[model samples]
Target: MPVALEIVSPEKLLLSRNVEMVVIPASEGEMGVLPNHAPMIVLLRGGTIAIHEGGKVTDRLYVSGGFAEITPERCTVLADEAVPTSELSRAEGERRLSAAEAEYNATDKNDVPSLDAAMDRMQSARAMIEAAAA
Candidate 1:
């Protein structure tokens, strides 16, 4: 049975269709959703989402802080920021990683949470770039 997935961004709809499976990056770790998946909600941490469809995996996305709402029939992701894997650039990813490191090093311990968040974003961006380049 096919599973429906809708990936939406504030500016646009990234994807909306039926798929066989979806592997998302949840705050705890990777979470897989399929047709008739149990209803639940998950907080997404920055990472990749692999979409499996029609005997092939056609899409990969970089997702930032967000929440995923799942139901028996469909899964919907509402993200703070989401970019298609194709949008990632190696140079840009490295630049972002450097900036995040700089910001983290320049901040105080009290700001560790925020710095860590930025680091996660940078790491996720890097991973996406690496995945695309492979």
Candidate 2:
């Protein structure tokens, strides 16, 4: 049986469909979701979400960061940002990375929150660059 996968960003609903499996970049690690999978909520990192069907990966999307709620029948992702991997631009990613690097360098080390946020941006930008290259 296929599992229902829904990926939504703050701007819009990016995808809603049934797939054989999904591999997500969870905070703990990569996770694969399939029909009848156990229920849980996962924190996603900046990386790719691969949709599997017909014994192969049919689609891939890059998520900046988000959380996913998974149940036996459905997996719903609420992403901060979502874009098709094919649409990712290496030049854009590079620009973002450079800006993030500057922000990180300017952020005070003692300001944990600001530092963390800057670091997250850097990570997401780097992930986008890698995804674009793939």
Candidate 3:
């Protein structure tokens, strides 16, 4: 049985379909979700979400960061930012990386939240560049 997968960003729903399997970049590491999986919620890292069907990966999406809710029959992703892997631009990623690095450097070390946000941006930008290359 296929599991229903919904990938949603703040702006719109990126994809909604039944996939044979879906791999997510969870904060703990990568995780594969299939039909009848246990219920849980996980924090997503900046990476790719691979949708598998017909024994192969059919779609790939890059997410900045997000939360994923998984149930026995479905998986839903609430993404901060998401786009098709093919749509990621290396040049844009590079530009964002540079900006994030500057922000990180300027942020006060004692301000944990600000530092973390900057770090997340840097990581997300790097992931976008890598995804574009693949």
What C-alpha lDDT do the candidate models reach, one value each?
A: 0.82, 0.96, 0.96
Q: What TM-score would you give candidate 1 relative to the actual structure?
A: 0.86
lDDT for position 25 in model 1? 88
lDDT of 2 at 55: 99
Q: Against the true structure, candidate 3 has what lDDT?
A: 0.96
Rank by TM-score, descending?
A: 3, 2, 1
Error of 3 at 13 (Å): 1.2
Off by over 4 Å in 1: none
Among all candidates shown, the one with the greatest TM-score:
3
Write the residue-wise lDDT of candidate 2 on 21-91 in tens digits: 99999988899999999999999999999999999999999999999999999999999999999999999
Q: Supply the global lDDT for candidate 1.
A: 0.82
Question: What value of lDDT does candidate 2 attain over all alpha carbons?
Answer: 0.96
Candidate 2 clashing pairs, residues 3+ apart or interchain: none
Candidates by lDDT, descending order? 2, 3, 1
TM-score of each: 0.86, 0.96, 0.97
Off by over 4 Å in 2: none
